[model samples]
Target: MRILVLSDLHANVTALDAVLEAAQGRWEQSVCLGDVVGYGPDPNEVTARLRKLGTQTIRGNHDKAVAGVMPTDDFNPVAKAAVDWTRAQLTPEHLSWLAALPPGPLATDGIVLVHGAFQDEDEYVFTPAQALDGLLDSTAEVTFFGHTHHQGGFSYQDSRLEVLQIHPRPTESFAALRIEAPRRYLLNPGSIGQPRDGDPRAAFAIADLDHQTVEFWRVSYDISSVQERMRQARLPEPLVQRLMLGR
Candidate 1:
């Protein structure tokens, strides 16, 4: 089955809608790596959409914070502020659902899903060395992770690990990666709500592991509208501004 992989959907409904529209009819099922809320407006709206879509989702750090599963002691002031605001905005039912989201390294349909590192759900895997453990220790040939909000991953074969520089070009919809056997992979689909991979477009991935292929996709959305909503919500200025910059 073709699977849609989403991550870091940090409450920007516009971006999420754009991605869904672009991915329509291309996927048979969906899974999320988490961060379903936080850093943007529409926390409740985004949570509702995720529930309606019924994507198999895992808890992100922000999700944990908002759900009161974890403390915001380590978060920066700006992030803590957004977390507080997001908490205030989410309905009791949505908050309960977010709290119940399972932490990942969740295995299903022939791939593994993780919000961060395989061993630590809160860690960020941004370097080849950092990605090594997940690549070598993961149970599946392909493992998808989020949290860094970057669209790329690491591939390992014969003990040689190489970072996969995979992303759709500015004018393209997706870039395909041919998944080869006897090789372990750790991939990031990027952030759906706030991208930090130097590209403003929303990012996601479609995997057809039976065919040995994965497609990294990027879609354009109405950033101005989302930013305006954030402003109206009185969310952090940095959070509102970063949507357009995709920082």
Candidate 2:
């Protein structure tokens, strides 16, 4: 079965919609790596849509803060503001769902799902040293992570760890990675709501472990519209600006 892999949705329903529409009919099951709600306009709508899809999900740092499961003390001023705003905007039902979301390193559907590193859900795995723990310790050969918001992966086999260049180009729809048996992988699907890999397009992935290939995808969405909504909601200007910049 082809599995839809999504992460760092960050409450941008428009971007999520564009991804779903673009990926429709190509996936059999769906899983979200985390941050279902955080720094965008449609917290409730995104949560409700995921609920309706029955996607297997895990919570991110922002989700934890918004749900009151974690503190915003570590958050920067801008992130703290977004967290406060998201907490206020989330519905009781959505808040409960968000609160109850399990921390990752969750094993399901033949693959592992993690918001960040396998050892620490809140930690960012951006380098080989940071990624080595998860690559070595994960139960599954192919484990997926988010939070860095960059679409790439790390692989290990013969005492060597290699970072995989797996992102699709701006002109391409998707990039394919062939998963090998002896080698294990720690991959990121990038961010859907707010990409930070210098690509403005919404990012996601489709995994077909049975076929031993995963497709990293980038799809264009209505960013101007989403930015407008963020402005109307009085969200932080920096957040609004970064969406378009994909910083």
Candidate 3:
């Protein structure tokens, strides 16, 4: 099956739409890694669309804050403000939907989907060492995770781990590696909204089970509109500026 892996959408509808449009009927299943809300415009629209898409979404830190499951004080000052604004913007039904989201790492069919690290659902596993540590503890051979908003993967070979950086260009083809089925891996699909990897484009992943390859894809959307919305909504200017340069 072809699965489209998405995470850290952070409620940017334009980026979400860009990802769906780029999928172009190639995906059989849409798997969301988490963070459906936070630090972006159009939280309602993004959440509603994902619900209609019937995505397998897990809970994100931002989602937790919006649902009031996590303390707003846990977030930074600006993040706390955005969380407060996001909570006010959401409907009761939307909050319920977010409240109902399950925490990860979830296993299905041979793949493990997680919001953060395997040890903790909220842990941010951004480094190769961190990814390797999670892989060592996971049960699934293909463990997909999202949190750091950086696209990368780590594979174990001959008792040594090799970290692979996911090339964002769709035109660049990758050779399928012979995965040992029961071994473990930790893969990040990257962030859809507010990419912080020095690239402003929307980031996602396409897992082709049949081909044994996970292709990371990035698509450009109207960042200007999202910025405009943030300004109009009176959200933090720093958060709005980050989207432009993807820093």
- TM-scores, in order shown? 0.99, 0.99, 0.94
Q: For candidate 2, report its TM-score.
A: 0.99
lDDT of 1 by residue, 30-104 (tens): 999999999989899889998999899999999999999999999999999999999999999999999999999
Candidate 1, which segments miss by more than 4 Å at Cα? none
Ranking by lDDT: 2, 1, 3
Candidate 3 lDDT at 214 equals 75
- RMSD of each candidate? 0.6, 0.6, 2.0
For all candidates in order, the CA lDDT equals 0.95, 0.95, 0.85
Tens digit of lDDT per residue, candidate 2, span 1-247? 8999999999999999999999999999999999999899999999999999999999999999999999999999999999999999998999999999999899998899999989999999999999999999989999999999998989999999998987788889999999989799999999999999999899999999999999999999999999999999999999999998999
**Shift of residue 205 alpha carbon in model 2, Å:** 0.4
Which pairs of residues clash in candidate 2, taking residues 3 or more apart in a chain or in different chains?
none
49-139 in candidate 3: lDDT tens per residue?
9999999889999999999988877689998888999999999999999988999978865588989888888888876777776788777
Model 2 residue 228 CA deviation in Å: 0.5
Local lDDT at 5 for model 2: 98
